[model samples]
Target chain A: MMQETVITNANKAYALLKADADKILKLIQVQMDNLTMPQCPLYEEVLDTHMFGLSREIDFAVRMDLIEVEEGKALLDNLEKQLNLIHEKSQQR
Target chain B: MMQETVITNANKAYALLKADADKILKLIQVQMDNLTMPQCPLYEEVLDTHMFGLSREIDFAVRMDLIEVEEGKALLDNLEKQLNLIHEKSQQR
Candidate 1:
């Protein structure tokens, strides 16, 4: 029963993470579509700091055993694959 | 010159991401050492939210051509592997 509860909470947390990631990606896509280079360095700086913070959170989760390592990787990999596709599309522009 | 500048910025950002990730993992290790289960659900909730934000930032960067998809994956994979090692050690306990 205890194990099941933890798993359920962890699963819900993962879903929230996934949903937020999708929202963020869409925001980026919108920004890209509306803007033209050269992008302001400030934007990159803000984004870098953001990614840094996220990576740390994932690390924390893994260490705490709050989420399995494989599941964490899947969350990150999904973002990477989606971003790669976006990058490829932009390149062809 | 322009291409070189962008590459340099991206490289620097990647370095920051790597460094921050390492710091986060270390922090988690420290927390685990001092604490015992069951962990606070609030803690997991906070970490999940943090990770979600960071993934978004990474996606934004990729969409902006600020970083390559491969590099982003590498950053995430490093965290995953390290966490896996930590998980394995904990399991053997």
Candidate 2:
């Protein structure tokens, strides 16, 4: 029973973190699609703020033992790669 | 057993959040004591970043049901009050 509960919480934590990462990606995508100015300082600030918030959440989950450190790092890394791709595409336009 | 586990997790969550809040307080205190520049933009930026990070952690805990919404809000509110007091003291100095 104890094991089951831990696994449940861990699963939930991973799902929540992924959802937040996706939210940030979509937010950036929307900004790129609408604003057409990836060079804007506001765009960078918004991305930085969201990334910081998500990193904090991941770090909390890791400290709580609900998620592994590597898993948390990968989540952030994956999101960064996607965001970078989007940024590059926007800049090429 | 399930109930006990839930309570244990909730207690842990609260303790972790309180510790994070205290760390932020200590960080600001050290900055104020050493730098003596509360009016500096860098100080404000640091405080803002830490506060934002803590808020994200609290929000995650609330969503996970590890802590109540009111409890999380209270934690942040209390920290803000203490920080404000510290800021005021430094300004008067």
Best by DockQ: 2
Q: RMSD per prediction, one decimal?
A: 20.1, 1.3
Q: After superposing candidate 2 on the true structure, give the runs of residues whose Cα lies further than 4 Å from its correct spot.
A: none
lDDT of 1 by residue, A1-93 (tens): 655755764665566556656765675576557653315664454445545555555554554345688887887778768866765676578
* Candidate 1 chain A: worst-modelled 10 consecutive residues by lDDT: A36-45
All DockQ scores: 0.06, 0.71
The alpha-carbon lDDT assigned to residue A61 of candidate 1 equals: 50
Native interface contact recovery, all models:
0.10, 0.61
lDDT of 2 by residue, B1-93 (tens): 889878988999999999999999999999999999998987887888889989999999999999999999999999999999999999898
lDDT of 1 at A66: 50
Error of 1 at A9 (Å): 40
| RMSD, candidate 2, Å | 1.3
Question: Model 2: how many Å of interface RMSD?
Answer: 1.2
Q: How does chain A of candidate 1 score by TM-score against the true chain A?
A: 0.75
Best by lDDT: 2
